[model samples]
Target: MNELERSVLAKIDQEQLARLCRQLIQAPSENPGGNEESTVLLLQSLLQDLGSTVHLQYAAPGRPNLIAHLGGGNAGGGLLFLGHSDVVPAGSGWDADPFTARREGNRLIGRGATDMKGGLSAVIAAMASVNQHAPHIPLTLICTVDEEANALGIEHYISTAEAAQYLACIVAEPTDLITIIGCRAAANLQVQISGASAHAGRPSDGASAIEAAAELVALIGENKQKLAAAPHPVLGPATWNVGTLKAGHGTSIVPDEAWLGIDRRLLPGEDPQQVLDALLAAARNRIEAAENLDALKLQIRGSVQMFMPGFLTDPEAPLVRQVCTTLQDLGAAGKHGIWTASCEGGFIAEHHNVPTVVLGPGEINTQAHQPNESVSVSDLHTAACAYALIALRQYETSQN
Candidate 1:
């Protein structure tokens, strides 16, 4: 490490930082309640210790977003490091306890290890480190909740008074140490199909909703194949999966209803409304062609559009330049690319005009929401060093 990098890393309290991360992982702030109060308080105290002003804003009752600011002077431009405190639910699989942070060999295992919390921890460490040097640029940390679900906390915060201040924001999402400049949008689609019901023995007596559902699923699959064959260049091609399907209630009766939940990831330039139009058209065609159907009906019941609005900062932008230089200066990973998966940065960028980038430590392929999810200790250390250097470089840029 160079003099600057070494100096920055030297200030990070590694043991204290790691302990905070573990304590948070043990809180089990999974969705439903998704209470981030405890974790937010822990971080709030750390920020206060660094001589920063802290504010805890609750979007809902228990869903709190923490903001802390540190400044040595007027600091011409502002920098916000964003992250979330809530984690996704830890379903069944696990060799070790999911909520209880377990350290073994060289990894820390937990639900949010790779998907987020580990990266969030690094930013906190970086904040503490920068505090020691008395940073010349004003720094703000926005740790929010509900990022794993609907990004309710961030959306609420941005729509309020807090978001108007920041000039630039970096979302600390797990990008495997790469600078994620952009991400494709994620959307939820619900397709409901209708048909008549009758006795199973008299097969010719009624229409089958299950049959229509099967046809719709097949049509969706065919559409996915077409999209794959002609993928988008920048954001990649639009892809989808039918995650949920439900049909009739009984084995002996002809099913009266069916529904499917489709998850679509839209590339940068794709039109979500057009995709819906096509899907409805395809479902109608397939259902009308059924052998003994009186009528085919379909409805686009619900959807959650992914909030990616296509943000790209020039490589020469002062912020981007500082980040690139920081990575190289610290001898950390030098790879840079936009992400294909969506993150909370999408919501923040669209709401507040701040140029947003997702950058952090954990690997993208770490099976984040699965059993025994873990983050490498070495990656965590490297991330702390990199983030600290980025903070320092941004301070230098603002001064110039």
Candidate 2:
């Protein structure tokens, strides 16, 4: 509510913000599709137009990430804004074309609109305003690819020495404008079990991978019970999910292979690899102890398909306070919360030791990944102002 904050807020262009949101939603950077290049290009041009120095780094061929720095940051560090370009597949059950962003009254409808594209657009628009009004504030915006499927883009980013200098990070995930100070981590493991094939008529003739897989599933259920006993105070307890199971070709033939998809949600201090190791070890022991099963002949191997670590920032942190204060000033209720879903914040927090906050413009539970995903147009405007004001105030406080 000072001169710079008021000026930056006034400078935000509402129509342009909505247009950019629609454009990004139309881009279709699906993670399973492995297409984030187009989204990166869109963001690169926008950031460049806003007077940011943009760098395009590919985590994989055709998978590009953008690192844009603006507002003349401080000597060694500055505020960082995190946005992921990739989105989950726009599955069936939409009222219209999922990729076609349709503005219906207050809601802008499309895939990625709620999950992140809306929030991402707000950040860019805020940076545009801030760049015009207050170019002296230091800010870095890193948009990564593949946050939905795997986190290779963020992994690649942290490996670079440039990540170590950030003072704080704001992940533009859907939070309905709530300021999230912590979130649980997510890791995906694909377990494949192999056994000798045989006819179902003779059960003892061949090892049944399906039967063994069932036993492991039951044991993992027990593991879930153990996890329920102890939960984190803020982010809640670690959890396990047996998301998928594929086995047996037909009713008459003994299946030769079994595939299992497991999802583990880790706490702030948990390690993804170590959790997988223990789960696999328990599966092996269960198979070994099972009666009439050939444990040595049966092979069970699993690997981490996607691993995202969790993060918890102190509620008293300046970045958290700034976001909350901004939210309150913008006529939105300011509160600290935790995200059950995973995002790129954990990677920045864990690897770079940056305090991370998740604040954005939409609803995660109701809108994100849902058909006809949408975000409030009003929420987008407020988010733009909030992001800009937070950056300006944070840098001012740091200087003081």
lDDT digits (tens) for residues 1-400 of candidate 1:
4576577688776666667678768767787567778778877887788777888888988888987887655332477788888877888879878988988877888988877888878887887776666566577888888877767787778778544656577888888778777777777677777667789998567778787778877888888888898876656677888998888979889887888877788875666777777788877776677666655333323344434334555555666666666677657656668676777777677766777777887776655777898887777777877777776666565567
Tens digits of per-residue lDDT for model 2 on 255-324? 8899999999988667878887887798889999999788877889899998887788899988888889
| Cα TM-score of candidate 2 | 0.96
- Kindly report which residue stretches of model 1 are placed more than 4 angstroms away from their true locations once superposed: 1-5, 72-77, 162-167, 271-274, 296-318
Q: How many backbone clashes does candidate 1 have?
A: 0
Give me the displacement of residue 256 in model 1, in angstroms: 1.9
The CA lDDT of each predicted structure is 0.74, 0.87
What is the clash tally of candidate 2?
1
lDDT of candidate 2 at residue 360, scale 0 to 100: 95
**Top TM-score: which candidate number?**
2
Scored by Cα lDDT, where does model 2 land? 0.87
- Superposing all C-alpha atoms, what RMSD in Å does each candidate have to the true structure? 2.8, 1.6
Each candidate structure's TM-score, on Cα atoms with residue i matched to residue i, is 0.89, 0.96
- Name the candidate that leads on lDDT: 2
Candidate 1, position 294, lDDT: 52
